[model samples]
Structure formats: C-alpha cells, structure tokens
Target: MHIADLQRLITRDPGRPRLTWYGDDGERVELSGAVLHNWVNKTVNLLVEEFDAAPGTRVLLDLPPHWRAVVWALATWRTGATLVLPPTTEGSAVVGQEQDRGVADVDVVVTSHPTSWTGTSAQLVAVPLPALARRFDGDLPPGTIDAGSAVMTYGDQIGWVEEIDPTAIAVEPALRHEDLVTWALACTPRPTASEPRTLVGEDHPLVVLRRTLQALSLDGSVIVTSVASTTAFADEPERLDRLRATERITD
Candidate 1:
C-alpha cells in the first residue's frame, strides 16, 4: 500500500485546523487541513511540472520553521521527492551565502528569501514570506521561479501520480513516510476535546512539523507562538491561560 501522510491526514479531517503560527512581528496564520492540502497539491504540481521533480528527486528545503516551509516539505514527499534538510545553523546565514551550501547536491532548492536568487545552478524557487504584490527585486537566475506566484496557477487536486514507496527515504537518518507518521502519532497527547494544545519555541522546523502533525493525528488543533511571545507569557501566566491552551510544548 502507498503511504502518504499528508494526504491521509487531509482526507481524515479536511475542515479541522491542523496548524497555527504566530510570528514575532505579530503575523498570524492558520491553516485548516483542506487549505494546507491545497497548498501541498499546488506545490507538488509546481515541482513535477515546472521543476521536473519525480520520484527520488532531491529537493533541498532551505527555509525557517514557517507555514510555507511545512507546505513545501509535505509537497516534496507527496511528489515522491527526497527531502533534504539544511544544516541547523544555515537559517542564520545571509541569503546568498546560505544558498551556496544548502543547494549543494540537490536538484531543486526552495527558499524563503526576500530577494530573487541568481547564483544556484539548481532549479531555484523563491517563496517570499509575506508574499509581495510586486515582482522580486534583482535578476533571477535561469530556471528560477517565484513559488508564491507559480503555486497559484496550479490545480488544487493533484492528478494521477505514482504511488510513493512507504520505505523509501523521505528524510535523512532512514526516516520514511511511515516512520514520520508513527513518530507524529506517538508524540500526540490523548485527546482532551476541550481546548487545543499550544506549542511555543524557537523556529526549529522538525519540532514544529512534528507538533503540527501530532495535533492533527488526534483531530486536535494547536496555537503555535513565537519564542518571544512565549517568553513574555512566562512572566504573565494568566495571559497564556487566557488563550485556553490545554498543553504547552516548549523547546
């Protein structure tokens, strides 16, 4: 049987809010399973149609722990592409320099940068945070495309595609689709049915991804706050309590 974690989750509960994000700049975003699934589908189409990403294609995801990053990761797997995570400290580097290291040995690189990239030899897709209304500044390299714009042109339903091998390497360290789903399920807490859980910490992609999946696996929602906001709440517990968060997962 084919294993598709995101697809299965969306199928199970399309209307439930699976992921919620709060940024330090007071930016907030919420994604229901259906909406997240649509983004993933569009991304998968972009990878397959524009980037020629097929099964086993190496895709380097060079972005912070934001909603867009999560969407790209799921889209990579859905398209049967191998997901390559950047180094832990890569997020701190300057944009151009960071792409040099992160894009190495990968067929495609999807990044969240403000400006267009003109360096990488690999297929580059720019996913600007707080997507701009105008085109990105600077000359884009050949094969570079704005992901924010491209995804909007694709269909929400991913058409016929090859079934993904459950045991295939989805991430490093022998992590497979089945393994990822199992880990997320294990991390999930028992359902309380009263209030959603809360996740607050640094922008770590793995932790954010896992926590989001954990909440979804139990048909529960989550409120993910920035580390700064979380720290502020530490001094004012009542403020955190006012959000009605049933549980708190911290770094």
Candidate 2:
C-alpha cells in the first residue's frame, strides 16, 4: 500500500491535530489533520511540478530535528520517492558514508545549515522549512486529487526522468532495546505516541535519577532535562543542576 495515501484519514477527522512541532524557542506549532493534508498536497505539487521530483527519485534529507523534517519526510514518501537522511550535521563523515554506500546523485538536500555542506561538490539544493512554509501560508493548495491518486500521479511523474529500474533500498527495520529506551525518553506525554512516564519503572524517582546518571556517564554533557511538568520527575531542572554542580558529569 502507498503509505502516503494515509492522507485519506484526514477526511474522517478534519479538525484533529495531526502534527505538533515544538520549537527550540518555546513556541508550539500545531497542524490540524486538514491543514497537514493540504501542506502535503502542496509539497507534492512543488516536488513534481516544480523540481520534477517523482516516484523512485532518491532525495536526500539533511535537516535538524524539527516539524519541517517530519513534513518533508512524509511528503517524500507520499511521492513514492526514496529518501536519504544524512547525519544531523554535514561533514566528511556524512559525505564519505553516502559515497562509500554508493548513494550518489542525491536529487535534493533539504537543510537548515547550509555552511556544513560547503565544498561537497554534490548536486545539493537547500530547502529550508521557513521557505517552504511561505509557499502555503497556512492555506490549502488548489487540487481535487485524493491520496491514492496523488501517489499514482507521483509515480508516473518520476517514470519520465530516466529509465530507472525498480530496486529496494537496504534498511534495518528493528531498533535495539537500549535505542528504544533512548527514543522513548525523547518523547513527551501525547495521545499519538507512548506516555513518557510509562517507561519510569520500579525505582520511581530513583530509577529515573539513576538512568539520568547513567546517560551522563557516556558523555559528561549528556543530561536528561524536562520542559513542563507538575510531577516531581528525576530529570527536573533542580536535580540536573545539582548533578552538574557536583561534577557528576565532569568525571
């Protein structure tokens, strides 16, 4: 099934918030189901009609952790396009990996940090989130196409680019237990995803505190901190400061 076709779920609940982007500046951006559907549609149009990107095209994504990255990824999937997520920051390591892995001809590169890729000599294009946002301005684009149709249209558009044979890209589909725990900690309490506190087990505050200390053991600066919470969690600001002041991480 075309995963991008998931847009159809929006019609059933147009008002439900489909995406919530928490900014580093303490700003929150919420996109309702209907709004997200429209943004993806416009994104698809721009990719196909403007950039000539289509299904099977290998697009590279080099973006920071933000809402725009989420939208761009989904939009690429919607177009049946293969996506390459480079390391968070650009450097020789990222370039060497893409080359060693034979991922040349990266059609596009969406990035917020442009200087990181200077002198890479790749066909890289910068597609920043703010710029893409200006394309729609919290409004829907003109189109009567449904989710399934969009995927088919995208597939056809890519077919004209080159006589490219269809092939599956290698990807690891499973996450290790520790990796899963790390991922779970990054999540906040939300309806769409798991509850963060659910991972807080037996030791109550102590377990979390110990885990936080363990997380710091690897990298002294690696600290667990909370944003907004009424409950007394181990990673609270006060505890983090105490740990830091005591040189718990320095050692």
CA lDDT of 24 in candidate 2?
34
lDDT score for residue 9 of model 2 = 48
- Against the true structure, candidate 1 has what lDDT? 0.67
Each prediction's whole-model lDDT (CA): 0.67, 0.43
Model 2, span 1-251: residue lDDT tens: 13333466443567755444434323446666677667666666656664566554666666544445555655665565666666444444566576665556676555554444544545444444442233222222122122222333343122233221223331112322123224333533311222111121222222332332232222111222222221233446694355346433332
lDDT of 1 by residue, 13-100 (tens): 6777666776655567878778877888888888888877766788878777777877898788787778887775443352356545
Q: Looking at model 1, which ten-residue stretch has the lowest summed lDDT?
A: 131-140
Candidate 1 at residue 83, lDDT? 84
Model 2 CA lDDT for position 99: 64
**Residue-level lDDT for 111 in candidate 2:** 52
Which residue pairs show collisions in model 2?
none
